[model samples]
Target: MKYFLLTTLVSLAFLTSCRTLQNTQKPSAGAAHQSQEQQYKAAVVSKAQTAQCVTAKINMDVDADGKQISCGGSLKMKRDDVIQLSLTFLGFEVGRLEFTPKDVLVVDRIHRQYSRASYAEVDFLHQAGLDFYALQSLFWNEIFTPGSRDVRSQLNRFRLAASGDYTSLLLTDAPKLNYQFLTRTSSALLDRVTVDGKTAADQGQFVWKYDNFTTLGGKLFPTSMAVSISGMGKKAGFTLALSRLNNDTDWPTRTTISSKYTQIKATSLLDKLAGMAQ
Candidate 1:
């Protein structure tokens, strides 16, 4: 159940990055001209190509079947470069996972468990239905970067628009997740994103507010976020407070895994699981 909650939260985070906008009255001529001017200014000054490093604290709240569980953790990330994450649950350190463009590592500090894999593991995780990459993109500064071709294809499924000093993209296919991206007129760094997933059909919606941004190494990153998931039956919310951001630092060079769980052995385990399912 915990893993299910983690996956759901991460997937929601991904959808939040591609939030949809609401319908508004058409703008006057003067307002339209002002919007074009702002877009031009944003194109000229937006930090679209810079890289950055960041660290954050995340608090998660899971509500299911009338029961609730809460957990907290920290993350360190480099934009389009690397990411290291450590999560704690129930007062026990869960594990530390790291991702470079070329490699992946999982270190269980408490149990002295570790695992390493090549970039192929990224796809493997995706196939395993894990949203690790999505989570990393949220914490890092690369969420504003153009999404993958596949992601673009999915986004094209919706209609998007722009509002005052911010682009308001709208998604109509999934009513349960209304997505929007609020960006400064002069930057790609999103200022605020409003997600309204409620309508006459759905009972309620979730809203996540991001703020406390600071520039580091020529890129901007958020230091705090408040997520509120509300519905009629089960409503859950929590705040993710971040601190201690470090730039251009390397995590552990090598991770030691148990001899019984080397790369070859892990692959064998995966293969056995696949065979059993067949």
Candidate 2:
């Protein structure tokens, strides 16, 4: 059941970078002045392109099945390299998750245990073709293709068009996963992203919604995000409201598990996370 903490932290990080949507109700972007591709590029993390790091203090609430947990945490991220997030419950540390290009390091402060896994070692992540860098892109407010880091080259795969109150970016017949991103037609700000696919352990449909925009360091940034992840047997997800963000400066680059903590196998960890441990 404690694996719940790990998954929650992991999912929360994926939901943050995409939250920079500025909530404006301008006049429907004037009938798509540019091509869909142009609109996508324009809508992505604009002023954030020059950023090498980011940090934010946020409040989170997560629900898995009928179980729910609420906590406050901080997100400290270094572009393309690592993300360090620490969760606290009433001023006490409860969990920590760090994502690097090579592995995910999780620390269960409540239980005093820790685990580490490469993308290939985590069955769900492996089957979904999700990696640390790809996750980082999503956190950085840029769209991503699992296993691909260059969003610039991958833009051609998406077909863009206006759909009612929103402009949509669609990837059909994808080799691994189908993806969709919706933006408000009025402001062209990203509203959400959808990921549909099956992992080794289950089929998954994930949606991330962005809102409550604010200006941080002179650039528009998202202050709130909601994540919904539903799989075959269960549903788990969370919502975040960021109270602070530092768009400049790097954070801790490595997650070092102490020798005092018990080391466990990656598969065993996943079983516990899925509540399949016997």
Candidate 3:
């Protein structure tokens, strides 16, 4: 159970929280006979200029640490700066994660436990060079560095090459993350992201694959996603399918943790995570 919560929900950062940011979509350049580098640069710029999403509702099937769970969830932005993600099973909420600029709040319904911590308090994440925005980029199907808000600068670090139907953008010299972003050449949509990184004692790689693009709110969005993390002395993976998506501007800004739950310290959360990773 601990493994399921930490590996599937916490580590993946699939949860969303408050505030919608403006994303302006620009006209894209046609592939034509442009060089691989040019095509990649164009895609990156186009995605960056695209309008950001407001809210989403997804149906997900999660598997991690040898456990499987099926659930429904919604992603909402409050006040244009905070994002909240809530998960439900059989009409009962089982988990919620709220991400702020400086901290993260996690709730586990099954155990009546909750945890709140900043990025600095999460040693594994600091070692792996991960942050909320890095994971948030995955939710948007964009390439990003953990702490960088500038997507263009992050794209500049990668070398682009044509690989079959996809353009592969790779960052090999990065200290912690060896990253690759793959996008379909025909549609210029992000198809996959694969990155290799490690904690202090464990090395792991995560792959996120996106598929089945459908137009939502005048822009393309993937309808399905498959994410897998391997190594770390264990393997974790999940598949998320979009059930409903909207441009709704209304959503709760805070995750309500009932008084029945006990809030735990961050260290206890880390200990539990380490044991599960092993």
TM per prediction: 0.54, 0.82, 0.82
lDDT of 1: 0.49
How far out, in Å, is residue 213 in model 3? 0.8
| Residue 124 local lDDT, model 2 | 70
Residue 219, model 1, lDDT: 61
lDDT per residue as tens, model 3, 1-278? 44455666534632211111111222234456335566557666575324444577878777766777777887775332577777887787777878876777888888999998897887766666667777667777777755687767666465666658876666666555566778787777888887764233435667889988777767787778898776555567788787576667555666777899899998887777666555
Q: Could you tell me which 10 consecutive residues in candidate 3 have the lowest summed lDDT? A: 14-23
List candidate 1 segments past 4 Å from native.
1-21, 24-49, 56-73, 80-83, 88-92, 96-137, 141-177, 184-189, 196-199, 252-278
Error of 1 at 192 (Å): 2.5
Candidate 2 lDDT (Cα, whole model)? 0.68
lDDT of 1 by residue, 1-278 (tens): 33423333333423332233356434335868657645543442354325455555666554433345666776766655566656687666665557765565655455454555664454444342324444454454223222232233343343335567665444445534455555555455655545554355544454566678766665666777765545434445555667655464555433456665434344542343233222
Comparison by lDDT, 1 against 3, better one:
3
lDDT of 2 by residue, 17-81 (tens): 12122222322344464464565555653535466777889898887665688889888888888
Report residue 241 deviation for candidate 1 (angstroms): 2.0
